[model samples]
Target chain A: MRDVAIIGAGMIPFGRRDEDTLMDMLAYASLKALDDAGLGDKSVDAVYVGNMGGGMLQRQTAIASSLVDRLNLMPAAAETVENGPASGGSAVKNGLLAVASGYYDYVLVVGGEKMREVTGWRATDFVATMTHPQAEYPYGITLPGMAGMFTRLYMEKYGVTREHLLAISLKNQEMGTLNPYAHVEMALDRGGIFDSPHAIVNNPTSADPLHLYDLCPVSDGAAALILCPLEMAKKLAKPPILIAGFGQATDTQTLQERDDPTDLKAVTLAAQKAFEMAKLKPGDIHVAELHDAFTILEIAESEHVGFFKKGEGGKAAAAGKTRLGGQMPINISGGLKARGHPVGATGVAQVVDIVFQLRHELPKNRQVQKAENGLTVNFGGFGNNVLAFVLRRVQS
Target chain B: MKKEIAITAYKCKKCGKLHYPYHDRCLACKSREFEQIKPQGNAKLLTYTAIFNLPWGFDQRFLILGVAEFENKIKAMGQIKADSVDQLKVGMKMKPSWEPIRVQYGEDVYGLKFEPME
Candidate 1:
């Protein structure tokens, strides 16, 4: 099989975008990526759209076909990928395999979710649909509820505290201010959100242990990438970022079924497979973007991915180890906490942010100096499904 | 008459791995054959949370939910009979009951419920 490389990446700002429809967001991001690749008059071989709630929220389906037609890219094969929150990563994986197999020379992978169009309650219910129909959904278990339980367990077993969680919340939200594309631009203050007398009102509990700030906001946005053979990418003007390795894994549908509920086995397996295929260890990674849908997840995934020892991830964040220019700068784009998680768009947006870092195009604040390699973890269905990718900047 | 827990747990005949809510194949050994069994005795609370921002269907301000492991090792999720998460603790004993967890179309949906047992 041939190697796949990303030639171009594009993303629109993430927030409550009431103006753009799901198809419009996908088409806009795709056009930006196509233009970024300098494919002015050229068309892709196929199109893959990643979406989770088009039919549920917008009453629209077959988004890939709609996007291809909207972008005037007729005749190209079109397909939509849905894997809960990992839809974007799954779509990219499809595009990568298609290009690597030599079946499609150029593939456009776009992920977008117009979640803001629906009420928060509806969105929460929609996301909860991923849970076990019989065992979990009936219990009214939302994602935050799952995270809250996980957080409680982690605290009891690993000694993780609210202070450690606060560190990530502050750090990521602060980074968000520097990110123009971030949905939450306001930086959180310790006094206002935690220490002050009015803290109760400021940061009310959404889930028992996790507060409002601990969870990511519902957002509407889209991101796209243009992928081709590594050989073909070299001919392009922009430096190519090779998809060095990728891995996808699944765990039990219900967390209670796992022997150890705190163990995010799928995350460990997926990251391990990606690292093994890349022939690189976690330490070798220059920058990383973890799926931080909840603050506790960032800590848990950081440990599961081998960035830190188990039980140490929370402390690491509290000590500034995961901050930009620190030991391993994570989520320099503000992560899901601040950048906003538009489910389908998040996986693609993570890669797009990394591409900017690897390309050395971002302002010094967000860019990792002379970064060579980056990694991304896109989590789905709680920890039931996960995907990991290792990207390397090809030195010209 | 006291309501009996209606849940059925399948034990993998090959590997002895127990499963709740019925799995087509055993998760550990992938055995096609299994011994059906009922969750026996009181359970231990494994984890729990009180969700404040509920979904569209739930009208209550908050709902307490948890997972518990029974004497026979049949683990399942259920609504916790507690005023708050403070009333629940991991590893604490819990009495499991079959009762209405929610209402759908004016019909009660019966599921597992756990009450703390001192």
Candidate 2:
């Protein structure tokens, strides 16, 4: 297989975009990526769109064909990939495969979801669909509920605390303030974060121990990436980001059936596979974009993915090791907590942040100096269906 | 009404795997042959949650109780319907009982809930 590279990446600001349609957001980001790649729409050979809740959120189906038709990319094959919240990452992986396997010279991958268009309660219900239909959903087990359970178990078994989880939110919010594309740019104080209005209302006791501030916001946004063979990418873009390694894994969908809820076995396996393929270790990564849909998730994920020893993730975050200018910066793009999680768009948006970091396009205050290697973790349905990728900056 | 709870599950005749609540096929062996089974009363609660909010159709009457390993070693979530939420804890022994979740149109959706087995 030929080597694949990301020539360009773009994302719409993550927030309530009721004024814009899904196609409008897709077009905005896709056009930006195309422009960044210095390629016209005619250069694209195929399109892959990732959307998890378009049918429930927008009452729209066959989103891929519709987007291709709207973009006027006639005769180009378009397909939609749905893998719960990891749809975006799945789409990008598929696009990379298509370009690498010689099926297409260039592939444009886009992921978007207008979650804020629906009522907050309805959106929660919609997101809850990702859980096991018979076991968890009927018991009023939403994402927050599941996260809370996992957090409780992790804390109990691994000796983590609410303070450790709070530190993650504080750090991400601080990094997000420097990001122009972040949804929540304001810095959050510890007291205010534990007592703020949004936190009080949204973070209310969804379940024991996990308050509202511990979760990510419902957001609307879209992200796009242009992928092509390494040879073609070098001619089009300056310093293309090479996809060094990609790995995906699956776990038991039902939380109860899993051997252990606190341990993310799928994520561990995927990361190990990716690292082996890339001939690198966790220490080689200079920056990371973790799927921090909840504050506790960032802590648990860091440990499960081998970024830190088990139970040490919370201490690492609390000590500011995961912050910018620290040992290894994480979530400089605010993460899913403060940056916003638009389900389908979250995975691609994470890669956008990595590309920016690798190309030195981020604001100086938040940029990781001498950053060369980056990794992204995108998971669907708690621990089920995890995708991990390692990217390296092409040195001239 | 005398409150009673039991661990309820759908047992697959082909694989003998027990599943909580109800399902058409056994997740373990992908079998359609199954029998409704309720393990004997009183089992340990593996974990739980005290939900402050209720979803659609659920009135603000009780806190949701997510119980595990009740009688049949099956996990399920249901309203406590108890007097207070302070009584719940991890590893607490509880009994499973039947309660009306809500009336959709005219059909009563029965939910499996757990009560303190003191």
> Could you say which candidate leads in TM-score?
1
Model 2 regions lying over 4 Å from their true place? A195-203, B1-37, B59-62, B82-85, B103-106
Instruction: State the lDDT of candidate 2 residue by residue for B40-60, as single tens digits.
Output: 656676666665545554556
What's the true lDDT of residue A366 in model 1? 87
Q: Please give, for every candidate in the order listed, the TM-score of chain B alone compared with the true chain B.
A: 0.95, 0.67
- Cα lDDT for residue A49, candidate 1: 90
- Per-candidate Cα lDDT values, in order, are 0.92, 0.81
lDDT per residue for candidate 2 within A1-396, as digits (tens), equals: 998999989888988888998888888888878888878746588999988998987888999888878887777889999988999999999998999899898898999889988776688778888877655676666777777667777899999988898898888888778777777887878766665565575446666777766778888899999999998877764689988888899987766666676778889988888888888899999999999998888888788778899989999999999998988789989999888899999889999899999998776897899899999999899889999989899886
**Number of the predicted model whose lDDT against the real structure is largest:** 1
Stretches off by above 4 angstroms in model 1 are none
Listed in order, each prediction's TM-score against the native is 0.99, 0.92
**In candidate 1, residue A132 scores what lDDT?**
89
Q: Candidate 1, TM-score vs. the true structure?
A: 0.99
